[model samples]
Target: MDWVVKFARSSIGAKAVVALTGAGLVGFVVAHLLGNLQLFAGPEQFNNYAHGLKSLGPLLWAARLGLLGMFVLHIGMAIRLQSMNKAARPVSYQSKKAQASTLASRSMLLGGVTLLLFVLFHLAHYTLGVVDPQFLEYKTAEGWHDAYKMTVIGFQSAPVAGLYIAAMAGLAMHLGHGVSSMFQTLGLNHPRYRPLIRGIGPALAALIFLGFVSIPIAVQLGIISLQGGA
Candidate 1:
């Protein structure tokens, strides 16, 4: 029990937890983006995809609960570690140099908070259907959830689309720093391949941000629609 308490309070253990959870989250983000890309395939295709997930019943709920737990763990540890870091510092350096650290790294807390807000709004808009009443009753001809039409209707609002795009930028910033930092935390830092490892984060962030923002942008631009032939 003492050892467990010590480890939980230690910086190293915090970093390890962050690293593992961050890696898992990155995988989830990739999968989620891929699944959402079904919007481009049109209504029936997208609705069928949504139906398939719903058909999973308990398995889908289990996955959702597991993902929720992971998010809670990751967010809790991040705030805890940040507080620890600040407490240890207590005072700012009179002359902080911006030598090796990037802007994304420096703004991790901001990015994380922004992403958290976005996630809440997103879940409300899509999962809970509490954000937009109009999209709540959408259904396909076959009685499946009309996820495609809902997406189209939701993103049709310029403000909604703009907010989504902005949130994705925050997500990109978070991931840009998080991916490389996780590798370093896990001690994958080899001098020879440090640059390559660091580059992976930004690359992945860009890809994900592009993929996510593309959806809202496409919907707003009328390049994708509920029916076939956008």
Candidate 2:
């Protein structure tokens, strides 16, 4: 297991985790966005999807546990790598040439930590079903469960809106730096296609930020209302 541990601690391994997690999240975003479009369709469509997810029984829990494990591994590798890099750079360099690029351009470690906090807050707000209990009070026709209500009410608070939006911005910054960097680490970097990959990375990140932020905006704007007052 010595070689396995060595590989797990390597830079390429850490990046491979990021790439895989980010790619997995891409699918998550698609499903979430599609379900959210039910906002236009009315509550039945959206709430039913929410109930269905809960009803997935052991399989749903399995998926959550699996994702959590990947998330933990990703964070652990990141911390280890950052510590190793800092050890390598104990002395400060005094020139622009000493550093390869802009702080934002070269600071994925910092960005990753910021993104980590954002993810916890996100799970608290949306996934844990506990961030805003008042929001969860909304119900569906099945009387099975009504999750969309909680969302509407939760973002009605200005503090929640501000916090959620700030998290999304952090996520955008993190993704902008992470995407192509992961590609390069995996040996997929090519002189010819580098520019294209780099260009598209930010666009994908922007879409993620905007899509997530849109729900809160809609609620704050009164475009979507909770089913009833608590």
Candidate 3:
């Protein structure tokens, strides 16, 4: 019991938890992107995909709950670690210089907080449809929820699209730092593969940012439209 408590209270333990949870979130991001990419195909395809996810029923709720748990753990530990770091170094350096830290690394706290807010906004905008009445109470001809229409309508406005793009920029920066740190936290960083591992973070972040922002940009540019069954 003492060991358990000690481990739970330790910084290393917190870092490990963050790494593991971050890995789960990265997987979710990729999977979510793939699912949404169905939009480019057509409404039938996208709506059907949505229906399939809804058809999961209990499994869907399970996944959502699991993801929620991961978010709570990741954020909680991250804040704790940050506070510990600050408390450990209460005095500011007279001549401070960051040799290894990048801008993304330094802004992790800001980016993480920004991303948390963005996620809540995103869920409200699309998941709960609380932000826009247009996203709410919409059904397709086949009696399914018209996700394609809702998505297009939500992103059609220049303001909404701009916010999404800005949020994505923060997400990309946060992800770039978080992903690379995971390997170091997990003891997977190797000298032989350090270059590759370091590059993977920003590259993956860029990929996700591009994938997600493209939909809104496409909708704004008229490449995707409700009339065209997007």
Winning model by TM-score:
3
User: If the candidates were sorted by their lDDT against the true structure, best first, what order would they fall in?
Assistant: 3, 1, 2
Summarize candidate 3's per-residue lDDT along 1-230 as a digit string, tens digits.
Answer: 89866876789988998999999999998999999888888888899999999999999999999999999999998888878777887775444344245344568888888999999999999999889876768899988889988998888889999999999999998999889889889998989989998999999999999999988888888888886644
> What do the candidate models score in CA lDDT, each in turn?
0.85, 0.71, 0.88
Ranking by TM-score: 3, 1, 2
lDDT of 2: 0.71
* lDDT, model 1, position 152: 88
Model 2 agreement with the true structure over 122-148: per-residue lDDT tens digits: 777776766766445555666766666
Instruction: In model 1, state the lDDT of residue 192.
Output: 94
Among all windows of ten consecutive residues in candidate 3, which has the lowest summed lDDT?
Answer: 95-104
lDDT of 3: 0.88
Whichever of 2 and 3 has more lDDT, that candidate is 3
Candidate 1 lDDT over 1-230, as tens digits, reads: 89877886798888787888888888889988998898888887778888999999999999989888888878888878878877887676454463244344459889999999999999899888998776768878887778888888899889999999999999999999899889999899999989999998999999999999999999878889655524
